[model samples]
Target chain A: SQTIHQWPATLVQPVGSPLSLECTVEGTSNPNLYWYRQAAGRGLQLLFYSVGIGQISSEVPQNLSASRPQDRQFILSSKKLLLSDSGFYLCAWNGGTANTEAFFGQGTRLTVV
Target chain B: AQSVSQHNHHVILSEAASLELGCNYSYGGTVNLFWYVQYPGQHLQLLLKYFSGDPLVKGIKGFEAEFIKSKFSFNLRKPSVQWSDTAEYFCAVSSSGNTPLVFGKGTRLSVIA
Candidate 1:
């Protein structure tokens, strides 16, 4: 079975600090990876998705960026965090095929103070 | 651009009450639909999905959803809900198999025992 792992299950950082969140998938190769943010009481917002290594499509313009360094390793980063950047960040993976269901990681609760 | 709309932001119901959560999407082309559940302090999990073939899709924990293409709607239903069913439900849509999903504002279900 495939599984996704996300690091720093909870994070607390001061404003303007650099941020990095990592996600990795096991038991699958060349999977589609995605980064999503869920604000309190709000639905999820897709931030970035990657089809392959070094290929990323951003869904919205924001302070965050994503990268796929390996076939199953994805990273979400920010040079400087903002107060608005604090939220529940989730990493998901799906089979390379289209319309496939996605599997999610435990998600990181980021708190930017 | 694809967008999803979930009618209720929050719902409170007693155990065994019927559930019907409305979801609508805006897209003219063929689309895929999905329902995800997020338990408290846990990651999001796929409840069900509709790609092709059957319009009514059943999922775990006695949850099901029907995709009505004519109305551009995929509504989740349950004949009887348990207190354990209390969670946040999200509706998502994608234009193609490989496209990034657009999620709704989400409906928070509170099933009181």
Candidate 2:
């Protein structure tokens, strides 16, 4: 079975600090990885998606960026965090060729103070 | 780009009550639909998906959804909901097999005894 791992479960950082969230997948290769932000009533907002290593597609223009350094390793990073950047960040992956449902990792609750 | 709409913000229901959560997507071309559930402290899991063929799709926990292409709608339903069904439900859509998914404002379901 495939599984996704994300960390840290909760993060508290001061404003203008750097941010880094990591997500890794096991039991699958060449999977499609995605980063999403879950808000109160706004639902899951797509931030970035990677099809392969070094290939990333961003949906929203914001202070965050994503990198796929390996086939199953994805990282979400920001040079400087903003107050608005604090939210529930979720990492997900799926088998691209099957058009299947995505599997999510336990989300990271980021609090930018 | 594809966008998804889930109108219900919160729904409270008693055990055994029927459920029908509305989901609509805006995309003219071929699309893939999915429903995901997130328990109180867990990651998101696939509830059901409709890629092609048979408009009605069945998923785990007695959950199902019907895709009505003419109406551009994919509504999730359950014959009888249980207390365990209390969670957040999200609708997602993708333009192709390899594209990133667009999610809607999620619906929070709270089932009581």
Q: What's the i-RMS of each model?
A: 1.3, 1.5
Model 1 ranges with Cα > 4 A deviation: none
Q: What is the lDDT of residue A6 in candidate 2?
A: 97
Candidate 2 stretches with Cα past 4 Å from truth are none
Model 1: per-residue Cα lDDT over A32-89, one tens digit each: 9999999866799889999999999999899999999899999999999999998999
Using all chains and alpha carbons, the TM-scores for the candidates as numbered come to 0.96, 0.96
lDDT by residue (B31-112, candidate 2, tens digit) is: 9899998899877888999889999999998999999999999999999999999999999998866888889999999999
Listed per prediction, chain B TM-scores read 0.97, 0.97
**Local accuracy of candidate 1 as per-residue lDDT tens digits, B10-109:** 9999999999999999999999899999998777899999989989999999999999989999999999999999999999988776788779989999
Winning candidate number (DockQ): 1
Considering only N, C-alpha and C atoms within 3 Å, which residue pairs clash in candidate 2? Answer: none
